[model samples]
Target: MALGRNISPGQGAKYYRKDDYYIEKEGGEEHKLEWGGKLARDLGLQGKVDAETWEKALQGHFPGGVEIQGGSMVDPKTGERCHRAGTDFEFSAPKSVSIQALVFGDERLLQAHKEAAAEAMAFLEEQVGARRGHAGKTWETTGQALTAYSRSCWTPILPHDGQ
Candidate 1:
């Protein structure tokens, strides 16, 4: 018998029986069939077959067997493929630019900028000291402070016109 075959009432007038059969009533109309009865009936089985035979047939037809092959090709000599060669892809050394133009425009603003940076650095150092002996904690605290300052400075430099 199918699992969950105990006789019990379900939604509306649907009732399940011990043999996995069910009676369903809709708009005062009643219909009866075994579990998966419609499918079996459609397959031309007229009456209930033994559980073993049904199970064997079901297992035989079950859509469970599948095989997958990993067919990715790799070249042992030169790693992975590149879209372009040396001429199309050129690399240049990174250039360091002054932060003065970014944070200040004039002499007065330059002094203010220096003071702000010093204060931020001091605050970060204090946080690192507070996390003394905890290597991960100090690194995390410093990273958070640096990230906040970097984000604040970079936000204005990013293009937001189209977005």
Candidate 2:
């Protein structure tokens, strides 16, 4: 009599046979096991011996894995796109403004300088008072009269002038 062949074998027999042992344990479909195993290997997931465990691990790693069931196209700059299974994208750093450049070289500094100049002008006005009308002419006339009176009083005291 001929011996019957073991079609669905156990993990031990499958491993010894050098076949897919995890697939045999999980009773995974042939095509699913093939694709899932490829994805798991590409992602470097450990202990993913079957399709079920592989899928679970993938979902745990990427919450949005279902959104890219077939595949996803993403903008590399924004990282806002659907990604395909086993697709590895590059990580990008976020853009930032320099604090020193913003504070020292911005319009705020110009406004502060204007305010300081105005304050200085106000302080000068408080010290010297505001200029009244014809104040320059009045001061000049008073100085000339004082000089003339002083010269007249000292004229007789000089010997050459007395002679």
Q: Could you say which candidate leads in lDDT?
A: 2
lDDT of 2 by residue, 60-106 (tens): 33223432133244534456663322222111112222233233554
| lDDT string, candidate 1, 1-163, tens digits | 0111111111111112222333223322222322222223344443333333333332223223322111122222345432210011111111221244444534554455445654654454445312434457643342221111111122223333220
Candidate 2 stretches greater than 4 Å from native: 1-48, 60-81, 88-163
Steric clashes per prediction: 0, 1
- lDDT (0-100) at residue 27 of candidate 2? 48
Top candidate (TM-score): 1
Q: Looking at model 2, which ten-residue stretch has the lowest summed lDDT? A: 144-153
